[model samples]
Target: MPNRLRRAVAGLIAAVLLTASATTATTANAAPSSGFDNWSCKPSAAHPNPLVLLHGLGGNGPGNYSFLGPFLAAKGYCAFTLAYGQATPAIPVGGTVSIAQSSAEIQAFVQQVRQATGAAKVDIVGHSEGGFQSIYGPKVRGYAGQVGKVVALAPPTHGTEFGGLVSVGDYLGLRPLVDQVLQQFGCPACDELIVGGAAVAKLTTGPIAQPGVAYTVIASRFDALVTPHETSFIREPGVTNKYVQDTCPLDPVGHVGLAFDPTVAQLVANALDPAHASRVVCAFGPPL
Candidate 1:
């Protein structure tokens, strides 16, 4: 199946899982469950900077981050997630808009989080396309000095092959058709993920990481979405690039699983606060 269809299928799965696993308390305040979207919460000394969660393509804030929000809050960190790239609110999928537009949304959200928490800066934790926003928003576009650290989970920093389908499409001269079909899903970001797409060409041509902002990319060798896997790796001098398999050899987590994996969550915690990093345990389970 094409990547577009696969994404639609993923959206269905997210909807089902969201409904099945929801608690009454969280469901009652579904807009911002698990300490997310809470304007009243202030940043604590132990966690001076608030953490923002960016979801992947075809994923909304609550659906993508229901697990990570509470996880970070338990660590005394103020976490927040917002819905962006929504060309159709009736459809409800997020991160479907162009990267440039999404970057603007991130900028606005970062400011809002900063004003609400009374913090000078915010740390970003993004998954998939969200990872791109975490970097582009702070480094290239908005949020300039307001961003401190960024942790990208299974990000296609360079680009992907649609799980090797891009090569097939290119060989058959179906690249444009494929891109068009994916874009029809109400997500222009999908077109940007194409191998030689304009977005990929532009992002890779410049310095991906900016000065004064710490960067970490946690990728999976087994990730099926980010083809070649190396696309997710950052070769910059100062960036800390981690392979999930290296941290836990038994981990079979794929692209989507990176967000749901508990081990990856622990890794995120470690990245957020390296000074007081927790000892990560090796375990096996579905991202749920």
Candidate 2:
């Protein structure tokens, strides 16, 4: 190879090595410096409401919000996470149970958080399926007053097109096949997320937002899962809707990437405690 080509290859290899090292380090130490899952940590005046994190679509607590947990804790808030909707009674994969079942689990968990922290209410942050659950739980379960704010990232508020599969499925009456495939993957939430599905239809038939809780949705235009992109928006009054590209044009974070995106994490921190909102950084890599 020419001298110039050799130099370019060497530079690229070095960059890749640096990125790999950074990713490893981040994964190893994603937990907060202050520590998490501590039942003893009480809410302070600066962070009065405890933050509950709900993971989305076949995700668990630690796997999904490892970075965000520590990030929020570093910001002076008590953060907690719950695992719900396991696919099979024997298996441990979450986000596979019905949305209602998961929502019920969330209600119980939030109640536990309130009792443990001795706080009147709690703030919630969720991604993908968790996004809608965070709101749906409070609204349907009559716990609206117990939640102060909800921040959803890349949530499918309305059912998704699945790249028009939903439309096609409806036209062809293929609900059973779709449900069967979702079941094979242990994704009960899939049935609910499909366009014109029962759970999705029920959520839309009523109000999407609760009476007192504040709602913020952070989504990406490039999200192929939630097609038309507009479906991610919460249409209820007083909802704060934001598209990542609008705030950071260069950001290409997609649906699942939102949880791992550090910029999106910062946005969650800001939403949780708006009085002391952090600066939104526009860097892209592993969310951590």
lDDT of 2 by residue, 1-288 (tens): 366744654454345445434543443344332234556668887788888998876556755665567666767667788777765545335666688888888899998988988999999998878887887777777888999999988777788877322211211123454355455765556777877877778777777888788899999877766776788788879699998877788886666567656778788877777887767878663211
Clashing pairs in 2: 260-287, 261-287
Give candidate 1's root-mean-square deviation (CA, Å). 6.4
Worst 10 residues of 1 by lDDT: 164-173
Each model's lDDT: 0.72, 0.70
Q: Kindly report which residue pairs in candidate 1 clash with one another.
A: none
TM-score of each: 0.82, 0.79
RMSD of each: 6.4, 8.1
lDDT, candidate 1, 131-196, per-residue tens: 877766776674557888899987778888883322212212234543554566544677886677
Model 2 — TM-score against the truth? 0.79
